[model samples]
Target: MHIVICSSIDFTPQIAQVAQGLTRLGHTVDIPLTSQQIIAGELTLEDYFAEKTNAGESARRKIEHDVIRSYFEKIKMADGILVLNFDKKGIANYIGGNTFLEMGFAHVLNKRIILYRPVPEMLYTDELLAFNPEVIDEDLALIR
Candidate 1:
């Protein structure tokens, strides 16, 4: 199955590993450009975030908006979305705003929603429960 790996920029290394694992399992995987760049060492989290900081709020917002739109396009083309929900700020299975938006896009597109981890008791717990995402833990084969 064609799958798009979705996660925050902070998880780029993990995203690359997950993408590789999915590819090894014979699934086509799509990752964000920022993640790819980070994996290639063409970009770093420090530099990426610094660029956003230097660009100022308005320009940064535009860049983020464009990136989210691009992700929506990828989600529309994919068979499913594999969320790499690692812990953040003490929240296990954390799903940040961007990942949540990607999930919404995939859910609305009728694409499969696969979570690499269980749903966390976060602010969006109710909304995430409503989506009924497939919690795969480490068994990525369940992504199909």
Candidate 2:
């Protein structure tokens, strides 16, 4: 199946690994530009976050809008979304704001939602549970 890998920029390495595994499994995979940039050594996660933080409000808004719009288009083209929900800030199976938004976009598009790990206790736990994403538990083959 064609799958788009979504995760925080902080997890780009892991996302890249997952993408490689999925590709080896004969699945088509797409990753966000942030991950691509990081993987290509064009920017570090710290630099990316710093750039966003240092940008003016209007510039930040435009950047965010463009990135999200691009991802929405990607989701529309994909068969499903595989979320790399690694633990963050002591929250196991943590899904951050942007990743959660991507999940919502996939859910609305009726694309299958797959999680690298099971949904964990979180602020929006109920909402995430409602989407009923398939938990692969680190196994890329489970995406099907």
Total residue pair clashes for candidate 1: 0
For each candidate, the alpha-carbon lDDT, in order, equals 0.86, 0.88
C-alpha TM-scores of all predictions: 0.89, 0.90
Superpose all Cα atoms of candidate 1 onto the true structure and report the RMSD in Å to 1 decimal.
2.2
Which digits, one per residue and each the tens of the lDDT, describe model 1 over residues 1-144?
999998877888889888988999999999987877778898777887777567585356548658888889999999999999999878888898888999999888899999999998987899998888999987877765
Question: Could you tell me which 10 consecutive residues in candidate 1 have the lowest summed lDDT?
Answer: 53-62
Which pairs clash (backbone N, Cα, C closer than 3 Å) in model 1? none
lDDT per residue (tens digit) for residues 19-138 in model 2 = 999999999999988788788998787787677678584357448759888999999999999999999889998898889999999999999999999998998999999998889888
